[model samples]
Target: MRAVHHLRGAAAAAALTLLAVSGCAEKDGGGGSGAIQVTASDSACKVSRTEFPAGHVKLAVENKGSKVTEVYIYAPGDRIVTERENIGPGTKADITAEVKAGSYEIACKPGMKGDGIRQKVTATGQGSAKPQDPRLDRSVAEYRKYVQAQADETLPKAEKFAAAVKAGDIEGAKKTYAVSRVGWERTEPVAESFGDIDPKVDVREDGLEQGQTWTGWHRLEKALWTDKKIGAAEKKLADQLITDLKDWQKRVGTAEINATSMANGAKELLDEVATGKVTGEEERYSHTDLVDFHANVEGAHKSYELLRPVAAERDPALAAELDKQFKALFTLLDKYREKGSPDGFAAYDTVGKDDRKELSDAVNALAEPLSKLAAAVAS
Candidate 1:
């Protein structure tokens, strides 16, 4: 239950960050035609044109206020078609969207409230403007090279730290671990791209002094470095950390290269719960499984943000599909909170076998879609 609680909190934090950056795209003006103008003042959300010519349309969002803001454009049925992230104070970003003839909503998170400010917009008549493909032609190659170097160089240091521990060189292990951890942190941006990699193997968890550190190699470090007896029990624990390190390295190769796939996979996972295929514990108990689930989703979304431009550039249709998946995921997560677990912590074990199996199946269904999406992006 404790583990689960930790993970849920971490997941929430991660999701907020990823969503802020990944989907924010301004609609471009269709072939020099007049574009809709959206302006956000320090106190209000305003759009110059609520109705526009159908086909290709550009949205120019201006943030004249002194705060960071986000704007989201939604089609009918509350479907978000495009978004602008982190529109700094006194700056503007142009987002281009191909608005088919339909009704839409313009949502602005002036302060990133749980519920954002939403307005209705409509498009009518024949329009045929397409969003320019994102510039992935050069960045994709650079990102791939970056990931490869991280795996080749950073993974070995982790291995060295494990070796130091195995040989009973406590001080040496600590030194190596510190160096390795720093390297891993440097690669955090890229590492977030992979679904299989775990930062706990390399990064130190925070709040150790307050018993708040929950995951990562730091968990092992707490056990190893504490002034406890160094008996067979301690040795066994140390061995487990070493094994985990090796296992993590092997899994690194399986990480998806494309960000959109990672994000889509996360979205699919959340959608499963939304559709009622998966059921979590009745109570808000902290469990390792729950924690891992949250962490996995958060990590996946982070990766998606980094590679979003690539996805938009390479395949706009795919990008749109991915956004659909994300909306579903978020909706499902909101439902999970609303439905609050009935049993709480005790429900984890008391649940019937059939129920457990159903839940497990649901989770896997979510994972499966993500895996397929990731594979597509990597390919």
Candidate 2:
């Protein structure tokens, strides 16, 4: 029994290592030359073939520009599968995905934001690969791991920041808060995509930049950071931040739907925007939506921090390990916050498409660390 368990563990580790090397894994079907050619350009995305036989189809994506790009495959029922990472300009990578007979959209985006070039694809004839089960898919698992990492890595430090503020240690609060921002920024790419979703319905869209109104928490950031006064208003602002942070932490743990719902919601909104069904002005209500999304994630982080004390009580050794991972995540978020300027909108505007792509890449970078933390915490 022990020997069998050891072998199984080794096989799982080997499989994971293979996944890391290939970036994507082959799902089904024997080897063949049946591959779809995909090309990325500065202004558009193109695919040599739109239709393919239903089965395990390999997509060879070639990036022909000066910037890195991401190719996303969206199938029926809003299923998104990604083959992403740094694909340097003038380079190429091949992704093998199990595709079934259905309508699909292949999108290539320079950055994760703005408009991406999309080509529609359809599959006909019989195929071996079956329709993907949404609940148990790898993408969903990846997303969950990402979210949990954000929570575990950043939340506690944010709570410490809040505690410092409450104790009138403003400088300490700022320094501690800086640590939490790193993890937050690490996850920003995935978070920003949430902006493309419907503003009113999705909680993630609370801090968008293109909207007419501004009601999200970042409105407070503008007030606190931009304002000259360091008086009562600052204190009030700090208090509000603390309050919101606490509330967010409480809600995120119990929330049933999770971040995946927000991602699906954003994809739907993006599709609507693409079809000319949803105008930008109508879709982007304000920068508040973006702020709200950040707040939501930050709240989750706070909840994760609160678990630290409990974790320590249960297992001090494990808690120490978790603290290190959390610290790294916090450092990343703080660095991201510092990289941007005081004028938030201007900072966002000044970022080029390539820079945005880097931001998205950074988001993907958090997956492994996050997955490790999530597995450790699993009951």
Index of the highest-TM-score prediction: 2
Q: In candidate 1, which residue ranges exceed 4 Å CA deviation?
A: 1-59, 64-66, 70-87, 94-146, 162-170, 182-189, 196-213, 217-379
**lDDT by residue for model 1 (1-379), tens:** 1111122112211222221112223234221247577787667788888887776566777787777887776544443343545578877766544455767778777764433677788878767543433443344455455445545675677667666666667766655544444333333333433332343343334322244434455554555555422345445545555565455455444443334323443443343332222344211122212322333344445455456666566566666665565555444333323123321122233445675565555454444334334323433
Model 2 TM-score?
0.40
Q: Backbone clash tally for model 1?
A: 28
- Candidate 2 per-residue lDDT, tens place, 1-379, comes to 0000011111211111111112222233212356687788777788889887876666777788777776766544333433344556787766654454677778787754443688999877767644433432443445446555664665576566556655666456434543444444333323322221112112222234355333222333343334423455545555555444444334333332222223322222222222211111211322222222233334334434534443355456655764564455445434334324321222233335564454334333433222232212221
* CA error at residue 233 for candidate 2, angstroms: 9.0
Worst ten in a row by lDDT for model 2: 1-10
Tell me, what's the RMSD of every candidate? Answer: 18.9, 14.7
Backbone clash numbers for all candidates listed: 28, 23
lDDT for each candidate structure = 0.47, 0.42
